[model samples]
Target: MIQAQAIRLFTNRGYDAVTVADVAEAAGVSAMTVYRHFPTKEDLVLIEQPARLIAERVAASSATQPLVLRVGGALVDAARALTGGDGDAPEASERFLLDCLRLMVSTPALRARHLDSQYALQQAIVDALGVDTTDPDAAFRAQAATSACLAVMHTALTRWAQDDGQTKLPALIERALTASFGDVATGQGD
Candidate 1:
């Protein structure tokens, strides 16, 4: 509810104009309550679920599979989960995601924070991939693979937002991944 209020306020009044107190009042809660839930104003906009979900999916993947297949398949799975398995998200969720993306792209502060979020996400991916910290080669491979996958994800998401949510996100993600990594993106390589 607080996030909904924050997004609404940020959308209507602009991120700089909308204070945390304003969001709190709009949400019918105290500033303390809002702060308790979201440590900073950016937290209201930056979602943490996708990173966690992707990491979980990657961790659950079969260890026997090739690294690219395991990482790419996990990314595809996360994309599917985002769309509720129907190639499209529910109307409200879709709108929320689009709005968040729009805000992130347009707002400078949010953009900077997004970079921090991306680094955290990369760390999660590397940890989930179980890269051996002692082996520089394995660590480097995991980092590079996760970076490529994340770049694909960002491209798809930016395209989706650019289209004003007209394109289905999961399809965009899958298409972009496949185009970039070939069969490795889908675990179909022989």
Candidate 2:
């Protein structure tokens, strides 16, 4: 509820124009309640459950699976979870997600916060893989995987948004992931 209201206000009024109080009032909650739920206004827009879900999925992947497959599967699982396993997403939900993405892209402050969130998410994935962040190789692999997943997400959302909310985000995301990692995995470029 808070997230939906925040996205609406941020999109309609501009990120800089919307205050915590405004968001709370729009959501019919107290300012304190909003602050309790989200530590900052930027956080209210940037924070999401998908990253955590991806980490969990990756952690639970079979240890024997190839790293690329494990990471790609986790990303697919997270995308599927977001879409409720169906191509049909509720109109309101789709609008909210698009609005949030727009806000992140249009607002510089929000974009910075979003990047910070991504970095933290990458660290979480690194930890989940039992990779030492201090090790150059481990760090490089984690960063690469995170970047690939984010690129897939960005492409999916951009394409979906451009389609005027017609496309299924999860399928687009899955395809983007496959196109990205598939080439590298198959040695198509090299």
Candidate 3:
């Protein structure tokens, strides 16, 4: 709840402008409590659940599946879960999601933090694949797959944010994943 409130506040007011006291007040908690949960203001605005879900899904996928397919499927599943499988997204509205994206894009500190989070996720994928990070091909494949997924997701979310009427984020994500990985699946080219 505090995190959600912090997102709303940070998105509305620029990151540098918003203080922990502001988020704490909005979340109805003490500033100390907010700091306890999130050591940094950037952490307050960053969404942790999505990354955790991605890690969990990747870890749970069948080993028999192609690495790309497993990674893509995991991403699709995470998108569905985040956007609400049936398309509701529970407490997070489309507007809020858009705001968060815009916030991340507009703020340098936030963007750096977001990139760090993504790098961590890619590492998790490498760990899940049981590949040595020092192996060039293995490392390249893991990083490429993770980067491709993130690109598709970002494009899908941007499209959804731009659309006026109701938009299905999960469907958009599925399409993005297909477009991004279809050629790879056919072994045509990388």
Candidate 4:
């Protein structure tokens, strides 16, 4: 609702160019209402609730999946869920996600949050898989699996953004994860 409007404004107008009032108007709400939902302007873009929910959703069913599948699947599921899923128009949702990502990269505060988001995603993978990071073998495998998944995801994101969404993100993720297993370092390599 309000968040989508804010994302759109921030992406199109620049984060600095958009204010709470502007987002409010765009969302058809009052500034007070916007403030009630998001305490600070940064919160408008930096809130962790959505990410946490995605983590929870991933955690629910991913525990039984194999390491690599779980890590990559959870991230893909989160992105799919957050980007409007099958209900919303696919193209509009893709554009919206692109805007949200652009907003994150375009602003310093949001950029830090973006890094944090990646860390959290990785940690969530480690946790959901119950990878004992203290054990040498477990730690190595966990790190390799998560790194491979994240590398693919990050690559997909970069390409998706660069090509202006000519590429479907899920397709990119699928191709990256399935098509390049040999290319990803497995710690066994060296």
**Would you list the C-alpha lDDT of every candidate in the order shown?**
0.86, 0.75, 0.75, 0.72
Q: What TM-score, to 2 decimals, does candidate 3 have?
A: 0.82
Off by over 4 Å in 3: 88-96, 132-136, 183-190
RMSD of each: 1.5, 3.4, 3.5, 4.7
- lDDT by residue (tens digit), candidate 2, 18-63: 8999999999999999999898888788756878998898799775
Ranked by TM-score, top first: 1, 2, 3, 4
Off by over 4 Å in 1: 87-90
lDDT string, candidate 3, 49-89, tens digits: 78788888888977666677667777778877776664443
Give lDDT tens digits, candidate 1, residues 1-190. Answer: 9999999999999999999999999999999999999999999999888888889999999777777777777777876676565544356777888899899999999999999999999899889988789999999988998898889889999998999877877778888888998976776666
Q: lDDT winner between 1 and 4, please give it.
A: 1
Candidate 4 Cα deviation (angstroms), residue 86: 8.8
Q: Is candidate 3 or candidate 4 better by lDDT?
A: 3
Model 2 poorest 10 in a row by lDDT: 181-190
User: Candidate 4 on 59-144: residue-level lDDT in tens?
Assistant: 67545456666666666677666665534355666777787766776789888878877787667666766766679898788777
TM-score of 1: 0.94
Say which candidate scores most in TM-score. Answer: 1
- Evaluate residue 44 in candidate 3 and report its C-alpha lDDT on the 0 to 100 scale: 78
